[model samples]
Target: MSNEKITIAKRIAKELKDGDVVNLGIGLPTLVANYLPDDVDIVIHSENGILGVDAAPDKSLVDKDLVNAGGSHVSTKHGACFFDSSISFGIIRGGHVDVAVLGALQVDKNGNLASHKVPGKMIPGMGGAMDLATGAKRIIIATLHTNNGSPKILNELTLPVTAINVVKTIVTEKAVIEVTPEGLLLKEIAADTTVEEVQSLTEAPLIVSPDLKSFDVAA
Candidate 1:
């Protein structure tokens, strides 16, 4: 991954609280595990039926047979356990997950998610995205500011949605935007960027935080 992408993952990691049961969606969201704080002790749950997941293993130590929901190679923590998909979905549906970190294609001002499908492309099934988005106590969207110069955050969604009004926080490479009842709030800008730059790149109108600050985080 690039430095910006890694930085995005790092910023998302800060949102995780101790003892929170977090379900990380596929793609960039999967990288958050690599930068978790030493003091935080969130349990990583993979929808593919494993709990107590550890950080991404070194390439040499990765076990091909041990993977996350996205089919990415992963390592298990000391007490990691595995089970069938039915039980995995059961845990998710039972409201056992605290926070879910998901990647996005488009998120609207109203906090609706559209990560599953776009206009013209093939994809695997939704892969528990709906369940996680609805079941988790909180939902955080982790993504870059834009896709190939086009904004992914918008005033309204253009693609098919994954879930509606479920996102609580959005951590992108350029800014930390919170999806609130009033509107999408710009909480923090990146260290190297300005609020103007962030707004210029975003399609949705932003409600600037009263205590707005620049991101001081390190990847």
Candidate 2:
């Protein structure tokens, strides 16, 4: 991973709290596990029926049968248990998860998320994103500020939305934004980016917080 992306993962990890049950989405969000605070105890939840999910194991310790919702190799923490999707979704829909860290294709000003599919592309479908977004106590999106030079954070989402008004915060390589009733709030700016640069790259208008944080890359 590039330093910018790794820095994004490290930033998101700080959002996790002790005793929290965090459900990590596929792709970039998966890296959050590697940077979690060592002093706290947090259980990782995988939709594929694994609880207490551990970081990716070293190749020597890889277990073919063990994996996360994304089908990537993973290890299990002590006391970890496995179950069927029924019980898994039940835990999600029953609101047992404290936070759902997701990656998004697009996030609009209103916090609508569109991550699962893109119009004509053949996708496995939305997976558990809909359930996690709706049921988790909090939702945080970890993604690049833009995609191939185009902004992913927008005033209006152009792709099919996975869920509406569910995202709580957006952690991008450039900034940290909070989704609120008023609008998308710029809570923090990247250490190397300026407010003008962030605004220029975003399609949505940002409400700069009075106590906005800067140099988040080192925080």
Candidate 3:
């Protein structure tokens, strides 16, 4: 993985509060598990029917039947429990998850998300993204700042929206942003990066926070 991905994961891990129940979406969002502080008591949920998820297990300990929502092998926490998808999604759609860290293809100024499919591309359907996006009490988008130099954050989504106006926070390699009723706010910038640099890669208008601070990735 690139340093950019690791940085995004580390920053997002800091957002998890004690006792929060979080659902980590597939792809980059899954990396957040590795960076979470051991002292923080948070339960990780996977839609495939595991709760209290821990980090990925070593290759030798991997179990084919025990995996996360993304189908990657993972170790279970001490109190972890297994159930069917019915119960898993019930926990999600019932508004029990405190936070959902999701990966996005595009996020608009309105905090809309587009991650399911690309136009004319083959996909395995939308999966549980729609439910998680709408059901979670808080949504945080964890993705790259850009896709091969093209801004993923835009004034408006160019693709089909996965969820409408549900995102609360966004963490990229270069910055941490908050979505509000007004617009996107720049909360923190990575060290050695500038507001101008972030803005240059973002299509939406960004309002810099008065109390903006440098993100300490090494922390």
Give me the candidate number with maximum lDDT: 3
Tens digits of per-residue lDDT for model 2, 78-146:
999999999999999899999999999999999999988887884769889999998998999999999
Steric collisions counted per model: 0, 0, 0
Compare candidates 1 and 3 on TM-score and give the better one: 3
TM-score order, best first, reads 3, 2, 1
Candidate with better lDDT, 2 vs 3? 3
- lDDT of each structure? 0.89, 0.91, 0.92
User: How displaced is residue 218 in candidate 3, in Å?
Assistant: 2.3
Please, what are the lDDT tens digits per residue for candidate 1 over residues 1-219?
988889899999888898889998877888897788999988999998998987668999988789888677878888889989999999888889999999888999999998887656846568799899878888899988899889999999998888889999999989999998899999999999998999999999999999998885772
Model 1 off-target regions past 4 Å?
56-65
Q: Per-residue CA lDDT of candidate 3, range 13-106, in tens?
A: 9999988999998878888878878888889999999889988899999998898877788899999999998999999989999999999999
Q: Residue 118 CA error for candidate 1 (Å)?
A: 1.7
CA shift of 117, model 2, Å: 1.0
Q: Sorted on lDDT, highest at the top, how do the candidates line up? A: 3, 2, 1
Q: Could you tell me the TM-score of candidate 3?
A: 0.95
TM-score of each: 0.92, 0.95, 0.95
Q: Estimate the TM-score for candidate 1.
A: 0.92
| Model 3, position 6: C-alpha lDDT score | 92
